[model samples]
Target: MGLEEEIQELEDEIADTPYNKSTEAHIGRLKSKLAEKKEKLEQQQSGSGGGGGYGVEKHGDATVALVGFPSVGKSTLLNALTNAESETGSYEFTTLDVYPGMLKHKGANIQILDVPGLIEGAAGGRGGGKEVLSVVRTADLIVFMVSVFEIDQYDRLREELYKNKIRLDTEPPRVNIRKKAKDGLTVNSSVDLDLDEETVKSVLREHGYVNADVTIGEQVDLDRLIDGVMDNREYVPSIVAVNKADLIEPDYLPTVESELEERDIDPEEAIFISAEEEKGLDGLTERIWDELGLIRIYMDKPGRGVDYEEPLILREGDTVDDACRKLGGSFDERFRFARVTGPSAKHDEQQVGRDHELADEDVLRIVARK
Candidate 1:
């Protein structure tokens, strides 16, 4: 049978099969088969070379994508956060195209993208889903904007992203698989594994692994094992913003926050704001900056004072050599050493080498060869 037919058959088999401790292995194998078919189908469909999706080149220090159901004020948020003129409306799907904006915060430039609103079946290519969902996979951060009244829609948006293999606020399963020529399946786990060896072997076999070495770093159940074996996934960090807070009463805002907390939303991730009213924007900006983990490097010239107005923006853990490369010249080849005067240095004007790791607000002066 074809991939679709095979997928449907496997789905039907999995649905009809009894789900229990005894039938777990059978169900797992069937699910693995289904996942493989679905992946293959997606590849085949996307491999057609037809390009009609919204493609935004990543710019600035980092790129953050605004994702939510329609009429969640993503356009308004983009305008408030950046200099982009994203059209806003009271209707759904107002953002027909990807709108790019730049948010300048703490001497760092952050690119904010207002994408088409997502709906149910988005990952399945519904309601311009393929184009919209494709942009989020490349985001450094996903701002899940939902209306204060429709706070529950955040779960639905997250679920759709999950179905598309975009894992938000989650880490990849700690399982590794190494294929071999003839060595039979050997499963080893550093921690207690709940999935039986036979089940693991069956799932691997369904994924076309007849012989392999499986290593599990942590305790994982059958679903985790399958996820590891499937292996085509993206782990992204996401934050949920409750927009249009001005529409709600002040006293009722606490109740809304309480409901969000009960749903296990992190206080840092879940914030109340009204983009139109420009309320709580500073907190939102700070939260985005912190979540992105950016570091600023101050550059100084010889006999000139440091320009703290626009510092060199770099990702956390970036080194001096990386900062030099950002200058867009042959400075990397002409590099000798640098003077450091920040938390990373011993004292004022300490001479450091090229490999010195830089810290935030560190003043640097690169000395080139004569």
Candidate 2:
């Protein structure tokens, strides 16, 4: 049988199997096979040009994908938030191509993409599934734009993204697998794992690792372990922007917010806005800024203090070496240290090295080899 047929058979087996201690190992092995088959199918699709992936070059300090179903005011939101000329209409799939826009906020240029609308079966390569989601995988954040009346679409959208290997609002699993030349597969866990050792070994064996060492540092389920084994998954941060809020009644806002809340979605982070009326856009921009978690590091000169204008934009938790590399060419390799001031520095101008982590609003002065 073909890879697709094998994948379907494995999926059917996994669905038919009852979940308990007895069948857990069998189910895990089936899932591993299923994942491998799907990966092979993806490879075939790529080779045959069946999945013509989107090719929008990443720009600005960060990229945010405006994703939703058709006629959800994504184009309008794109135009309202940035200087993009994406066509807007009151019909489905108005934005056919990925339109790029630059939103300048808090001294940072954030690139927002308005891609073609998604639909049901998008995860199965329908409605430009691979193309649209490929762009999403490249995004630093995904702003799910849903209409006020179609609030339930959030769940469907998330489901499709999840199926596409885009783990929204989730961190990477803290599981590690090491292959050894000898000894059977040994499983070690720092925390309580939902899957037993037999199940883990079965999954590992299905993935072509007959002998290996597995370390589970976090409380993980079977699916999480499989995700750790498969290295192609992308974890992205996400937020929601309920568009066309002006059409809804003022009293109805609470119901919408409550719906998102009941689903464990943070209502406080969800922005209610009308793209046509250009309402609540500042709040949306602020939310995007905070979600990106960016930091600014000002460059300091000896005896001249910090150059507050044109600060180096860096992500949170970036080190001094990262900052040096951003400056380009041999800076990181230069034989010298740096002087730091601000929250990260103990004193006014403390001497630091490449490994020093930088904080927001910090001032850095590098003294390279003479």
Candidate 3:
């Protein structure tokens, strides 16, 4: 009989099991056989054809790219993140070619691209600026690296991106300060200033709060700014890495944090890590993984003659039905049932229905009639 006919017969047998004790063991045996068939079907499907082992094309996995001005430690961070031997140096444009590496976290592998350092006027075809930013645009996430020691570094980088029309959500607003903090007036204490609403709006606009309405003494929402940066790309998330933390003085950390806050970026999302020292690398990796919403699940079938060592990485919302659909329409129609063998399984081996949700490291054994 065909796979479909076999599944139908098993279903009928299961329905009649309670009615007849003579076929109870037979029904159980059918269930086991069906599970084995499904496992083989899925294994064949997974190995069909794909660039990255998941039977999908390139860019199927979430991609994160490192971007920043020259000599900003982008290459160093890439090396630290992936343990890949990417060239790093204090000289500008040390990395002329884009290097791709996979960083595995919690079974999910994230493809990270390290692009060449960008300079001012990069978008205008100057200093290979536009070409570099174009590459950055394709990235799902952009890690903007900056050196704290450089005077007005943030402003300079923003100006370069603006001149090139390289869109960055965190550009600060421009304002002429006619009123300074009064002598002996501390920042903690409030002082009256002759500033109009338009002036305040213009200032806020330069600080990356374009089209924002504001009032004097009113607090600005930083979370909204972070959301704006995230909205720069569709469905892709971004994270900030505050590199050279070891070089900067401890007292300067708060000021840097406040500046980022003013630009609408959260201090928490901006990780402070020394790529050279490998300090806080774990935290950075975890943050990136969390933001990407990726996970890995493995199917272990010892006697199934399939590779169980490598796990499948999937998005957070992926389901068993979704996976089957990815295989092909026929597989979905022929899907009889599924069984899982892993730490999360209810029993040593349990039958799973069509609507079953898969967890990380789940060793699934699917049963198909054929």
Whole-model lDDT values for every prediction: 0.85, 0.87, 0.58
Compose the digit string of candidate 3's lDDT tens values, residues 144-183.
Answer: 6666554245566555554433455433222122223333
lDDT of 2 by residue, 240-347 (tens): 999999998889988988888877878787888999999999999988988998888998866787888778889988989889988887776673999998989999
Worst 10 residues of 3 by lDDT: 49-58
Q: Which residue pairs show backbone clashes in model 2?
A: none
Q: Name the lDDT value of residue 127 in candidate 1.
A: 58
Residues 139-183 of candidate 1 have per-residue lDDT tens digits of: 999998888887788778888888788888878998899988997
Off by over 4 Å in 3: 1-60, 127-130, 150-235, 302-309, 325-334, 340-357, 361-363
| Per-candidate RMSD, Å | 2.4, 1.9, 26.3
Best by lDDT: 2
Ranking by TM-score: 2, 1, 3
TM-score of each: 0.91, 0.94, 0.57
Better of 1 and 3 by TM-score: 1
Using TM-score as the measure, the top candidate is 2
Q: Model 3 shows how many backbone clashes?
A: 11
